[model samples]
Target chain A: MVSKNQIKLISGLHQKKQRFANQLFFAEGVKVIQELLQSNFELEHLYTTLNDFQTVHASKRTVINEQELKKISALSTPNSCLAVFKIPAEKEIIHSGLILALDDIRDPGNLGTILRLCDWFGIEQIICSKETVDIYNPKVVQATMGSITRVNVSYVDLKLFLAQTKLPVFGTFMDGENIYQSKLPQDGIIIMGNEANGISEEIEKTVTSRLTIPRFGELQKTESLNVATATAIILSEFKRNS
Target chain B: MVSKNQIKLISGLHQKKQRFANQLFFAEGVKVIQELLQSNFELEHLYTTLNDFQTVHASKRTVINEQELKKISALSTPNSCLAVFKIPAEKEIIHSGLILALDDIRDPGNLGTILRLCDWFGIEQIICSKETVDIYNPKVVQATMGSITRVNVSYVDLKLFLAQTKLPVFGTFMDGENIYQSKLPQDGIIIMGNEANGISEEIEKTVTSRLTIPRFGELQKTESLNVATATAIILSEFKRNS
Candidate 1:
């Protein structure tokens, strides 16, 4: 049974400011919660309709009814379980290998999907601009499907970070060299831009390499690929021959 | 001005049954509405806050306030405009070149993203299982951006359709041959499966070529790519060399 205060706290974690203030974020569903439990993320509490996660200590787990679960769920349709985990302090950027840099990605789902793609291609580090959506957003946690535990994501001043990095910075542009023809390196930062805008100007200036995924469709009226799918193709190209 | 009756009609289009019965669907936002107007889709009516789309006959356009748009819109945050288009009859499936077959894509956003990806890669035909989300779903039309104007999508019995196809059929599987090394054909059907189930067992038998996108992450714990991103990778692979 969850107390009134606990429900308020869990519901408040849906917002970035509240999550930051409490140093905690919650993930719903058995899969994500289980992954968090196995990873370095420290669990604050667990609320569930089912009496699962038997390994969790009695002090940490609360058996709640569906009505109680609905009160704290960020989802429109509440899952059977929701686990709150303390947000670990951002780790030092692992400056090596293929690091993905985001130029103000605003969508939580896109960020989450990109993280899953990074995990699939073995790209370990992600550097997000200060304007990017928070990784702890409930929608992002749901979209990541457990990949949140596998990647290291850090939000920083992207322009400053790009200026100082020794690694080659890559960003896609229409007038840039074709990605299929370009020689991609194992160690570089691939910058994906905002949904409505391509990479911001200051970040574009820091890009050492500019690449383009050539459009194959005949009409050429299709404006652009969604950022997450664009990242998929770019990552696949970079990893295909390696 | 949007009348009470008009608002009810537009709101009802949110459901597939109502859309089909009325033989109409609505798209929100200026870009999507503009694309639909330019395409073969017949404009049933348009409701907008702005006095834009000067080319549209004034008789077909209704200027309404944000509050009125909110009552008729499917989105939580309504866009500036919503346009209802008569659902065009499905076109004949283009038999040649690369085709994307969705087993049972349930999410409207994924279907929209895949359509956009198909447009990017010049995959002209999309065959969807009957269970797949309707292509004319407002969320899909929104997510497609403008690509909905270019791609041809049809719903069919995917199992029977696959069983009779003359072209080589391809589907991704964990144990399938490495896609990067495989000799991908210029003409084939690439089947993307359901969000949760991957490919159904009966449909799996019809796949003549089994391909896999190799995982590069070191942990090997990452399960699978999201359906839309996976579609991007597969479509990119097919077009990169062609």
Candidate 2:
């Protein structure tokens, strides 16, 4: 059974300020909850429909009914289980592995998709700007599709972070080095920008290397690639070459 | 002033059956509507609050006040312009350039994003399985930003289409060859599968080559890349190497 406080806490996670104040976010879906349980992320409270908590991992979890689960779920159809987990503490950047740094990315879905991309490419650390979409948004959580466990997302001053990093910051732009021919560093941050605008002007100024995914057609009418999709392509190339 | 019939017709285009029956689709926003005007795609009607249309490409455009523009808009919040255009007939397969075939892609936004990707990567045509989402869906239209103008999308009996195509048919699978190391053909039909399931079994049989975007993590729990993003990466690599 869910208590009033539990419902309130879970609901509060929907708001960015509330998520920040509590330093926790909610993840639902049976598979997503199970993945969270198996991962290193700290679980605050887990609510499950099964009284017995059937899965081997779910055994340690708390049980609740469908109604309780639905109340806490951002999804119209709540999964069998829901869990609240602490936001993983900021970890020291290893700085050697390929990291993704996002500048002023406002879309939760985009950030979540990027997180999934990072997990796919085995990108260890995503050093995001404070202005980047909060990783813990329920929508972002949904989009990550259970990748939130493996990848460490840290919010930092993006402009400062980009300037301080020793490795070359490769960012995308209209006119830049042809990615096919460019020598990609084995280790560095790839900065993606906001949906409407590329990277912010301040962040763009700090980029050491400007790279472009060469356009295919002869004509110059097609607008820029979707940010998440662009990340996937760029990451695939970088990982493939490395 | 926006006529009642115009409102009904614009609203009706939102559905797949209606779009097909009416032989029209709608596009919104300044960039999207402008792209349709600039590109070779046929525009049946153009309504805009902006005056720049007459100065450049108002081939057969009508000027409307912001209120009328709002009345005709399909967006959540109205934009400055909206246009209803004929769904350009899918051009005959030139059979020379790279092509992408989608199987049962139910999401309109995914379809639109894929079209944008197709346009950006210079993929001239997309062959969709009969069950694939409608290309004219307003959400798909909105999501494409503008690339929908350039990519020729056709729905066909994928089986028949695959049987006819002379180029290699490549499909992505978990057990397939590493896309990076595999010998990718210069021109072929890349068959992207259904959203929930990978490729359909019938179509999978027709795929001459099977390629996999290898996952980085050893654990097999995380969700694979979204179909749209995967398409973007695959198309980019195909074009890049070619």
Candidate 3:
């Protein structure tokens, strides 16, 4: 049974402001919750529909009914469990190796998908502009599929980070060099731009090299690839050759 | 002003069964509506708060307020316009070129994203198993962002389609040859699988070539890429060298 206050608190974590205010964010489903439990994220509480997660202490775990689960669920179809974890402090940016930089990615799903992509490519560090969607957003945590535990994401002034970085900064542009032909290096920052806009003008200027994923369709009417998929292709190219 | 009957009719288009029953689907936003108007899709009716799309015949267009739009809209934030279009008869699948075959892509967004990727990569044809989500799903249509006009998608018995296809058949798997190292061809059916259970067992037998997008991340615990992003990478590899 969940208290009324607990329901309100869990639902509030759906918003970034509440999450920040409380220093807590919740993850749903057995898989995501289990990952959070195993990682460094400190669990504030756990609610389960089933008697699973027996390892969680009695004090921390609540056996909730589906009706109660629905009250706190961010999903349309509530998963079996929801676990709240304290948002750890943003870790120091690991500058080495291939780093992904985001210039104001607004979508929670895209941010989550990009994090998963970063995990797949073994690119550990991600630097997001201050305006990018919060990684702790419930939708993002859900979409990450526990990749949030794997990839280290930090939010900073992107322009400042790019300006100070010693490594070459790469951003995609319409008129840039073909990525397929370009000699992509292992040690550099790959900047993906906003959903509607490509890299921001300020961030674009900081880019030392510009790359283009050439569109092959005969009509060539597609304005751009979705940022997350574009990231996947770019990371694959960067890692394939390395 | 939208009549009660009209509102009811348009709202019904949100579901696959209703869409098929009425042989219609609706697209929201001026951009998507305009794209449908410009393409082969026949407009059933157009609703807008703005006096745009004036070229649409007076009888076919209705000026409705935001409240009216909210009633019929599938979007959380209703766009400036929503247009219902007749679902045209499925075009015959173009057998040649790089044909993308989906074994059982269940997600509407993933299907929509793959369609956009196909448009970007210039793959003209897509064949899906009957179990795949309907292309006319509002979420899929919204996510496609007008690329639905460019690509030809059809539903068929996927196993039979692969068995009879003269061109090479490719599917991604854990033990498959590395896609980066493999010589991808211009003419073949590259099959992407369902989100949870990838390329069904029966369909696997028909795949003549198995390819894997090698994971580079150190931990490598991420089980798989989202179907759409995987499609993006696979399509890029096939088109990159061609």
Candidate 4:
């Protein structure tokens, strides 16, 4: 049984400001909640319809009804469970081996998918511009499918970070060298741009290597690939021969 | 000025049953609407807040306020315009070139993103299992970002189609040959499976070539890639050498 105050607090966590203020974010479903439990994340509380998670201390979990679950769930169709975890302090950026840099990626879904891709490709670290969507956003946590536990993501001033990094910075462009023909390195930062815009102008200036994924479509009218998919292809190419 | 009846009709198109019964679907935003207008799609009507699409006959266009546009829109935030178009007859599936076979891809966004990827990679034809999500879903039309205009998508009995085809059939699997080291053909069908259930057992028997995208992550904990991103990587690998 959830109190009205508890419901209001969980709902407020849906917003970035509220999440930051409380240092709390919630993940839905058994899979994501389990992953967080196994990782370094600290459990603030758990609410579920089922009598699961026997390992969790009784004080940390509450057996709630479906109606109660729905009240706190961000998803239109509420999952069986939702668990709130404290947002750990940001870790130091691991500056080696195929770091992905994001230049103002605004979509929570895209950011989450990119984290999963980085986890898949063994790319450990992600550097996001301050303008990028907060990783603790519920949609992102859902989309990551528990990959949030595997990758290290840090939000920073992207232009300054790019300017100072010793590693070669790569970004895709239409006039750049074909990625298939280019010799990719094991250690570099691959920058993916915004949905509506490619990499920002100032960020583009800091890029040391410009690569292009050649369009095979007949008309070449299809302007761009989705950022998450683009990250998948770029990561695949960089790691294919490694 | 859209009448109450017109608003109801547009809202009904959100459902597959209503869309099929009416033989029409709607697209939101200026770019998507403009692409459909230029293509074979016959415009049923257009509603816009702006005085754009000057080429469209005045009889086919209506100037409406943002509130009215919201009433007809599927998005949380309505674009400047929405246009309904006659659902064109499905074209014959082209038997040649690299074909993308989707086995019950249920997400409208994934379907749309895959269509866009196919357009980018020059894969002109897509064969969808009858169980796959409708290509004309409003979310799909929006996510396609106008690539729906370039690619031809047809829904059919995917298993039977695979059994009868003379070309080699390919599908990704956990124990399959590593894609990077394998010899990929330019004229074959690549099957991407359902979001949660990979490929169905019956359809798995029809795949002549089994390939896998190797995982590079240290923990190998990422269970799978999103269907659209997987499609992007596979298509890139196949076309890179050509």
Candidate 5:
């Protein structure tokens, strides 16, 4: 049986401030819980309907009813399982892999999708600006669909990080050279920008090379590409051309 | 002053059947409404707050109270203006232009993002399998931002469409030719598959050339890429190589 206090505590994690103070986040759905269990991520608690007692160590599992599950779920329709995990605190800067730096990315879903993309591309560490959405946001946690366990996401002052890193910084710009034709270094930070805004002027100055995914239509009426979509194209070209 | 009947009418457009029966869909926020008004789409009604009216078109707009706006709004926080527009019934099929055919895409946001990509790339038509999510879904509409106003989306039997059309049919596959080196046709259908499953087996048979976006990281464990991100990269590459 799950206690009322336990439900309240798990529900509290839906809020960012509460999550940050507690250093924990909630991930719902049976699939997400199952994936997190096998992961190296530490599970503070797991609540499920199936008495998934056989799945984890005694200290980590909690058998709960459907009514109790609903109280802790962020999803509109409550799922059978929900798990809370402690956010990993140690994030090491990898000097030689394909690192991604997000500049003021606001959407939790976009951040989560990017996290999944980073995992798919084998990007080791995701460097984010202070203004970027927290990876632990319930929406983000859900959107990653289990990739949160594998990818390391850390918030850092992007300007300071870019200025100090002794590696090539590639930024996307309309006037920049075409990404298909441009030479890409094997190791560096590929900085993606805000949803509506391109890279900030200060960070733009630090980019060693500015590359663009050339528009197929070349129409002035159409606005620029979405930030996350652009990131996909850039990553594909970088990896494909390399 | 907007009547309760009009408010209810706008709210009803939220559902797919209602949108179809009434021949209308809702567009919210200042940016989306402005783009809709500027596009070829015909507006059925426009409701806005007084603050928004100061800069908006005079005389043709309906000035509504915030409470009334709340009644008609699909958003938790309503924006400055809301518009109900008649979906354009006639869309020119430019056979010579690059086309994007989505087969049973389930995610509204993914479809919306693809539509925006079409707008950015100047892709005039996006053919959808009937099983694909409605373009007017609130989540999809929100994700497209304002690009829905510019892109044409039509639902048809995608397999039949692929078979009937004389142009080349390119589908993404795990073992297909690397997208970077593939010789793409100037004008053809680029068929993207469903979320959980890629292109359907039926659609797969008709694919003239199967292509794959090769992943960069050697140890990547994920079976396939996100459909929307893959769409973005594929579209970019097809345009680049052309």
Candidate 6:
């Protein structure tokens, strides 16, 4: 049985500002919650429709009805459970391997999908511009499919970060060298741009290597690949050779 | 000015049943509408806030306000315009080059992204299981941006189609040959499975070539790649060598 105050708090975590203020964010479904439990994430509370998650202490777990679950759920169809976890301190950026840099990616789904791809390819860190969507956004957390626990994502002044990094910065552009023909390195930063716009002008200047995924379509008018998919191809190319 | 009946008819096109019943579907935003207008698609009507699309016959275009567009739009944030187009007859499947086969791809966005990828990679044809989401879904159309006009998508009984095809069929699996090392053919079918359930058991039998996109991450628990991104990577590999 969740109290009125608890419902308000959980719902508030849906927004970035509220999540930052409380230092907490929530994830739904058994899979995501279980992943968080197993990771370094500290659980604030757990609300479940089923009397499961027996390992959680009695005080931390609340058995709630579907009606109560619906009230606090960010999803249209509430899952069997939702678990709130305290947002851990932002870890230091691990700059050694392939690091993905985002220049103002606005969609939560794209951000989440990129994080999952990073997790898949063993890319440890993602550097996001301040203009990028917040990682704690409910849609992102849900879309990550629990990959949120593994990746280290940090939001910083992207231009400044790019300027100082010793690693070669790579970004895709139409006039750039064909990615297939280019020699990709194991340690470098691959920057993916916004959905509507490719990498911004200032960031483009900082790119030490510019690559292009050549279009095979006959028409040549299919504007661009979706940013996340572009990242997948780029990451695959970089890793396939290594 | 759109009449009451016109609004009702346009709104109904949002559903697959209504779209098929009326033999029409709608696309929003100038870029998508313009692409359709340029293609074989016959425009049923056009509603716009701006006095644009001057090439369209005056009789077929209506100047409407934001409120009226909201009433007819399927998006939460309506674009400046919406144009309904006749759902052109499905073209014959061109089985020659690399073809993408979707086994019950249920997400409209995934279908759209795959279509866009097909366009980008010059994969001319897509074969879908009957259970796959309709290509004309508004969300799918919107996500495709304009690639909808270029790619040929046909829904069929996938298992039968695979059984009869002369070309080699490829599908991703855990124990499959590593894609990077495999001798990928330019003329073959690459099957991407359903979002939750990879490939159904019956369809799995029809796949002649089993391929895997190896994971480089330390923790190999990352389940699978999102269908669209996987499509992107696989398409890249097929085209890169050619």
The candidate 4 chain A region of ten consecutive residues with least summed lDDT is A216-225
Ranking by lDDT: 4, 6, 1, 3, 2, 5
Docking class of 4: high
Candidate 6 per-residue lDDT, tens place, B135-241, comes to 99999999998999889999999999999999999999999999999999899999999999999999999999899999997897789889999999999999998
Q: Which candidate has the highest lDDT of all?
A: 4
DockQ (Cα-based) for each candidate: 0.87, 0.66, 0.88, 0.87, 0.66, 0.86
Indicate the docking level reached by candidate 1: high
Instruction: Please report, in order, the local distance difference test score of every candidate based on alpha carbons.
Output: 0.93, 0.83, 0.92, 0.95, 0.82, 0.94
> Which scores better on lDDT, 3 or 5?
3
User: Per-residue lDDT tens digits of candidate 2, residues A67-107?
Assistant: 88888899887778788889887778668779898888898
lDDT of 3 by residue, B103-193 (tens): 9999998999999999999999999999999999999999999999999999999888888989999999999999999988899999899
Residue pairs that clash (backbone atoms under 3 angstroms), model 4: none
lDDT tens digits by residue: candidate 5, B147-224: 887777888888888888999889989899988888876688899999987888999988998888776565565566
Mind giving the per-residue lDDT tens digits that candidate 3 earns over A1-242? 99999988988888889999999999999998988899899999999999899999999999999999999999999998999999998898898999999999999999999999999999999999999999999899999999999999999989988899899999999999999999988899999999998788888899999889999867998887889999989999999888
lDDT of 2 by residue, B168-209 (tens): 999989889888887777778999988778898889989998
Model 1 chain B is weakest, by summed lDDT over 10 consecutive residues, at B30-39
Off by over 4 Å in 2: A1-6, A48-52, A55-71, A76-80, B42-44, B47-72, B217-223
For every candidate, C-alpha RMSD to the true structure in Å: 0.8, 2.9, 1.0, 0.8, 2.1, 0.8
Task: Calculate model 3's interface RMSD in Å.
Answer: 0.8
Error of 5 at B149 (Å): 3.4
Question: Model 6 has how many clashing residue pairs?
Answer: 0
lDDT of 5 at B181: 87
Candidate 5 C-alpha error for residue B84, in Å: 1.4
Winner of 1 and 5 under lDDT? 1
Question: Of the pair 2 and 6, which is ahead by lDDT?
Answer: 6
Clashing pairs in 1: none
Candidate 6 chain A weakest lDDT stretch, 10 residues: A214-223
